[model samples]
Target: MIVFDLECRRGQHRFEGWFRSSEDFARQEELGLLTCPNCGSADIGKALMAPHVGRKGNQMPVHAPSVPPPAAAPAPTTLPAPAPAAVAAPAVSSTPLPPEAMALMHKLARMQAEALKSSRFVGSSFADDARAMHYGEREAETIHGQTTIEEARELLDEGIAVAPLPFPVVPPEQAN
Candidate 1:
């Protein structure tokens, strides 16, 4: 017996059919007796054959045919869901504002101006004036002026009630 790989011209479905010889396949095809089992197509022809297997004494041997590789893979059927709600929030700063916070500092300097209108401009004499007021050598009054951190520290060490203003005050001579 001989086997032929046959394909349907209409649906291109391929399968194998047994015959007495290669001539038998040709004779069946010429007689229009060949049909595709998959799509019932009668327009059939011999499919391309792979390398033949070993033969017997004046006879042919049959072997299981190889399967064709897939033309395309199937699409995925499912998708993942959204995550849970237990995520932690991020932390932010908790420190006090600096002495140079722009608009707020400008507003604070204006408030200091109003407060100092009834006070005095001691210029760089801030440490001396503050000490004199602390010792009762001068009348106690609101004052704003320039002083280094060292001067502020000395005044504070001497038990003066001096507090560093939140903004630098421009001297009257430096005003625009």
Candidate 2:
């Protein structure tokens, strides 16, 4: 698999896209499948990125490690207690979104909120819930939750329909 930095011309939003090959990316772009997650724009293209070059096989180490003489241990101070777990803030982009992009984002967020009104938030049990529903072990209904990419792929391999949300969801418990 190869990763490419993609940018949306409409919003100037940058994101990564993974593909089997360069041809795969081109095919997706031609088919209008490539889109910006932030502004839902289809005007996407590869972004400028520095090439990654590896050292030659016969090249020696750039910096050799030096060993120092062992010293006596003399420190035994009281350690500070660990801080409570806290939710991390989302990463802010260095560049601000265009006005049109911001407007579109707001509209998309509102649309997602409306669509999720009747859907259930299953938290981390998303994969299990989806599998159960798929296997007829539970009643099938609209559900949204968290799951690892590997788990999602497994579900898809099992013929269960699943899709990723365009935006991150705030858990009901974490919502004010």
Candidate 3:
């Protein structure tokens, strides 16, 4: 026996019925044998069955309570934001020399040491001795010593030839 969902046209009522075959159901339907139990209407036809679309994979049909369709969603909105100026930037100092510059300074220091191999060290009297040489009171010779930028500039302004040492020089007194 086969069961089918049947309906009556006069009352639009749905019901289930059993039959020996599809042909038996059709024959009975043709002979006005099917009737709605609730309405007793013989104007009966097979109800359109909802297509049995099986769930794919591990999915199951969710049996949720009926909820009214949400009202038309409000127009999309944007969040308020602070001005770009109000955002705090990362604190970074611009004064530090990069690794490449520091490496170059070290390389230049080595090169300067090599070039000053024959030069003499005059200790802290660099300014006075340099001035004396400029005035022809002392013999001119290659010399290197510690001097401030201001003192070097002063020497240069006085027409004295003074070039900065590219590296710190070891004082003769300090050399053991």
Candidate 4:
């Protein structure tokens, strides 16, 4: 399978599309089957990409010129063939997170867990509960729950201090 970096012209969203081959991708695009997964836009095109080529174990590395050749400098008596563009990014080295990154993630998870301990899980009534707290109808207390994006935006626009949690929590009813 070949992966193409595809972009949606409408939303400018970049995503990868896998096809059997380059010809398969072109055929799909011609048939209007290609689409942007983000916005569902059919106006998809290949995004600009860097070249990728493997180097032989015995091949020597090419050194970049420290300085550009002078414009007035005499031309070389014999010019070598033009070299191809830059190589692709290095391959992923490991699947596991680095020590420092793992540590930070653990710290953030701990903080979130601790914060959730004091917060009430109101489930789908998050926006309503938040509004009640803001209006003093309910006592001001820590709360965390699920709400639609539109509801969350409405809460923020109404000057209610509600922020989404970094991680989702299991509701009391669903948890042991």
Candidate number with greatest lDDT: 2
- Stretches > 4 Å off in candidate 2: 1-93
C-alpha lDDT of all candidate models, in order: 0.75, 0.83, 0.75, 0.80
Each model's Cα RMSD: 34.9, 19.0, 37.0, 12.7
TM-score-superior candidate, 3 or 4: 4
- Please write out the lDDT profile of model 1 over residues 63-150, one tens digit for every residue: 7688665769665678765322110122355876786666677798798778878877889998898888888998988877878899
- TM-score of the candidate numbered 1? 0.38
Please give the distance, in angstroms, between residue 111's alpha carbon in candidate 4 and its true position after superposition: 0.7
Q: Which tens-of-lDDT digit does each residue in 108-166 have in candidate 4?
A: 89999988888888899999999998999989889889999999999999998777777
Model 3 segments beyond 4 Å from truth?
A: 1-103
TM-score of each: 0.38, 0.46, 0.39, 0.50
Q: Count the backbone clashes (under 3 Å) in each candidate.
A: 0, 0, 0, 0
> Residue 93: error of model 1 in Å?
15
Q: Which wins on TM-score, candidate 1 or candidate 2?
A: 2
> Whose lDDT is higher: candidate 2's or candidate 3's?
2
Q: On TM-score, who's better, 1 or 4?
A: 4
Model 3 weakest 10-residue run by lDDT: 82-91
Give candidate 4 regions above 4 Å deviation: 1-94
Model 4: residue 67 alpha-carbon error in angstroms: 58
Candidate No. with top TM-score: 4
lDDT comparing candidate 1 with the true structure: 0.75
**Pairwise lDDT winner, candidates 2 and 4:** 2
